[model samples]
Target: MSVVVLDGSTVRSFVADEAAFSRSVDARFAALDTNGDGVLSRAELRRALESFRLLDGGGFGSTEPPPVPSEVAALYDSVFEQFDADHSGAVDHAEFRDEMRRIMLAVADGLGSQPLQVAVDDQGGSFLLEAAEHEEAMIAARVRKESKKEADGK
Candidate 1:
């Protein structure tokens, strides 16, 4: 399902309170780290995305089901590249926390007074995936509609 995530107040609050934000980020990192490994790999990130049910949805019709696992992995790759700071191929809790703080701060600061709400809700950074999915759906639907008309000799 598509969801709306408002980043202004929530992010601003997190930015304003470093301790609380750290705790919150730590809790999230621990969850995503899984296996108590203290680091998040591509596999871990994929698992986390699946667990959050963030890897799929947005009216994907029967002809075109939600993204396959590889597509999700590709998304994770881009996310990891951006978040992995140290080139360790894995993201530690500290790195995760710092990155989140940076992203939240950017949103809060860059957008100014207006609340920034991204429908993609990918947890961090761009909503490119979400926007692309919606756009593709619209295009697919239009194609299907036109095809049906042609088949009916319209």
Candidate 2:
């Protein structure tokens, strides 16, 4: 696991780079589309989401009881519906990309200006981790350039 520092701007900048964002999202989509079909069936999406454990209760201590199975099912259904768009019963790459972009932007908004330390698994497919890595690479390149310029002057 690696800890990455990221703020809203970091994610926003990543999203703004349309080509990079699309490439990442497309790669993820391809992985999820296990059947090699061009689109994601509801079962495929639900299975993937379940594997991620995103539906697991937040770490926050809640006084309320855990959600019943039906409620969980409904929530998953709703999420699938959102990604389906056009009521097409399946999620195409375009639909998946659009929804992922919206979801990432919402996460960015929630993060606001506060930098968060996130521990991510090296093999975990996280877009935020990718953004942080990209930011670090850019900073490294700039530092190298400045050092070379100073060396040339001396």
* TM-score per candidate: 0.57, 0.87
Alpha-carbon runs more than 4 Å astray in model 1: 1-10, 60-65, 106-154
For model 2, how does the per-residue alpha-carbon lDDT over 25-142 read when each residue is reduced to its tens digit? 9989999999998999999999988987765665479665666789889988999999999999999999999999999899899989989998876785789988787778778989
In model 2, state the lDDT of residue 106.
Answer: 94
The sequence of per-residue lDDT tens digits that candidate 1 reaches over residues 79-133 is: 8887889989888877887787787678666656564445554554232333334
The lDDT for every candidate, in the order shown, is: 0.66, 0.88
Clash count for candidate 2 is 0
* Span of 10 residues, lowest total lDDT, candidate 2: 55-64
- The top-ranked prediction according to TM-score is 2
**Pairs clashing within candidate 1:** none
TM-score, cand. 2: 0.87
CA error at residue 86 for candidate 1, angstroms: 0.8
- lDDT over C-alpha atoms for residue 11 of model 2: 86
